[model samples]
Target: MVRYIETVLVPYTDKVKEELDLPIRQQSIAIFDVFRAHRCQEVLDALSKARIQHVFVPAGCTGELQPMDLSVNGELKAAMKNEFMNWYADMVAEDLKDSSTINKVDLRLSVLKPLHAKWLSKVFHDFEVKERHYLARDTGSSAIHQDRGINIEPHVFELYIDLMCQFKPNEVLNYIKMNEGYRLEQTLQICRKYKLSEATAFLLEKAGDIQGAFGIILQKLQAKLKLFVDVMQGGNTDKDLNVLFLEIDTLAIVIIQLCQRNSGKMDEASREALWFPLLETVMTPQRKLKDIDNKDVLDDFNKLTHHILNSMMGYIALPAILQKIMQDPAYNTGKFGEVRELILGMLETYNYEQTLMKTCKNLLNHDIHVHLKSLTSAAVRGYIPRGDNCNLCNKLFINQNETDSVVVFRCGHSYHLPCLRSVGSVHVMDGEEMWACYLCSHSKRGRIQSTRFHRSLSNPNQAALQQTKEKSKEMTLDSQHIQAIDAVRKAMKTPSRMAILTELSRSDTRSVRGSSGIFHQENFQLRLAPPIAPTNS
Candidate 1:
């Protein structure tokens, strides 16, 4: 089965992918049964190689969840059974007429004839129709209604909204706004009945009842904070603590939005009462970092801190809260200053991390600089070799003395330097000076540029480039660094290199240092350079 999938199914999928002009990973999905055959490593490997995400139906629920099992397969089985029964009846009738026993050879022939003629064509036609129906249903209700039913029940829509509200309240709110039939009052009633405070608050706000929405949000926030206090004061499971933190963050967002909308109407006293406890939940350290052994719990705490800081930054009544804090005698001490600095530092670090993540994603999705760099490195290292002849001129490199004139790129294509330079001059005239390997350059037409790289180049001081040059001069390229770069260049050929790069990029320097000292003691010293101050002209 695995071999069939690899040899046949994947190739067919590739053909379809080409016809559709889709990228390698095109959100292709495959549903598989929970049979042991589908669960085998070989089958999974084939699916992954084809870039098809394989999802398994729950065991014993294939009939309900699997469309083929529900429709096409059932039809095919019934058609085959009917054909066999007809053949059996015909054979029995002939036997009764001849008054002789039904011959095994005749029975086999009867079964084989219908299987090829009647059953095969019937099953094929049925499968095609049923498969189309199944696909239409899977696509959406509009497609399903076009084929099956024009009108659906009101209760079905209600059930769907209820389910969506539980999982995705924001989506349900959007749906209610777009759909005229979906009444806000009815949805709000359902939300309140189900205790979906988030959805209820959203609906109330949409109804222009901002104060009501604020009240609901505030009530939920207080309840969640009280739960968090209880959990912290008493011994609670990590799961409970995590839930409390998430709830607190979610409620904080609602409160922030409400406060922003009613900023003029809301009084300072009400704002203080509403925001103080929420701010304290974040500003006051719930527990010492050393006391939390679980990494997940620590991460949750950081996430909650980020959420609280973001909410405060967005909150319209921030000035009121700051005034309240300043006027309080307890905050007059040095502790308030320390807490304020800590909050600012956390926010800065969080913003920096988010920016880094966005930059990395942009690079991965669009930048070709990394590929160009790899090509350049391969060219410098003489990794690209001539395959018995110069690729540009289509002539054999017979002269051993002229071999030094040959230039090979990292892509293993070689050409005479003069031939490459002639072509490169044309590219340079077109505003692209850095010539890439023929194969790599022609694979994509875009120039390699990154935001960070461009920013560094455009800087007045060129600080990043200066820093790089200084580092290079301080620690000249060693054999280890060359070998490591080579290894990375080689690994870039594999699909997994992207994931490896992402992981490496995200890793903290301390963790990397603990794992391996890439910088040796004899060659390098660990010293912190004093921060450079920007000069005013």
Candidate 2:
């Protein structure tokens, strides 16, 4: 049946279509709790095709899919309550019609269908909201304002400001508003005339608004492009180039957007300072720079590194070298206020602090212990693949006599069963007649296949079978002798046990020296008395 959803959602909906929300607007989102659970490959493939970027919610948070879990669970209970009442009413009506009949079937149908529909609707809506809340912003640009006189009209300025404002509220409200006497129009003019480099510096030092700094950079890039165009057309401007402005602007924009997307992560500010110099080196004319000795820059570099460590917490183990550097009290505590401030600024740009906080709590509450148990369970299922080929040897034995028989190993690698069985008797560990892997020494551990050389060994004719059984018995006897030898070698380590065993071996009665009727001293004396003469008489 075609179900009409009032909004765009269904159970196991497409991810790209679902999570259109951005800046993590919802307190919770309903994604599959485990990425590997429930048609995840199909969903993930769809997301990849749709170019949807995502941060996986930490495990155990599906119960917290924002408002859905909170509100929908209660709604389900209420629906159940209503269903019960309705069912009761239906039963009463049926009883009135016929006092003897329970009318069980109709009563059940009345209560169940509506309640199920209601609960399903709640779940669908909850997921739909989560999807819609995460869609990326519209990225197409509509116009370019490239005038260079610094006195463009106010209305145009407001329109551009409004448009930019929609994308970056925190940036504008928290930083841009602080710059007085410099309207957006003037910033644009400065960008057109001085190149984005000079203008970005002017804005950063003068206006302190990062957005304004970007505005200047954007104009300078446009001017540089125009300059390039003019030169290609056989004309060159005498104006000196200010290339660093464009470079700084590009890097700054990327960093700022990262900050915006991550909800003012705590480490972003510091990282940005570090990121600028590295990015500048890429664009600078010299192509290399002297070692960065700026204390503020160094601190920011460390902060950026730490932030990356937090962001990729699920994957790489942070390098010990970096961790060691970061943990030093002198490095952390001796910094200037601006250096410290830069480091702290990064925290404002992303939620790394929150993630760390959550992790710390899990550690404290023995969540790690539970996690370790789960890991051990998963480990038992299989080894984590190192992206290498199967390491076990593939060779299998084929008994010359048996064509049909094959032996299997416990590890699932297969060999000719008949050949393997001929080599080793049935292992008592598992009922299967199997052979040990020569490499791993695990008998009955892998799958065994029949080989060409061993057709007769597998034959079940009485003569062949009897012969095979006799051979097996002989092998068992030999194996027992080997085991006995091994046991003797083990026992020989103790001098007293070895002495008792040696004396026992010397006599026909097969009794130890102390336990037999003849005492050791008496037997020796009788041997010396020449008892053979009395026997002849």
In order of appearance, the predictions have TM-scores of 0.30, 0.17
TM-score of 2: 0.17
lDDT of 2 at 514: 49
1-537, model 1: which lDDT tens digit per residue?
Answer: 877877877777788889999875675678888989999998888788778889999998987899897866776777888877886788788887887676543546665875668677877766755654554344344643656533444565567678766765656655555443456787788888778776787789888787678678777776776676666656676646766777777767767667666655656665555456556555454443326456775566566655655555544344454566678776555434535654567557667878999999998866577788877886577373749876544555776545437666657888766545534422554565555565466447666321111211323356456556555334234454345434443433332334345645765856765655434324333457999999999
Residue 361 local lDDT, model 2: 94
**Number of the predicted model whose TM-score against the real structure is largest:** 1
Best by lDDT: 1
lDDT of 1 at 395: 51
RMSD of 2: 29.6
Q: lDDT tens string, model 2, 304-356?
A: 43444344332222343234326756334532232344335544533566788
CA error at residue 270 for candidate 2, angstroms: 16
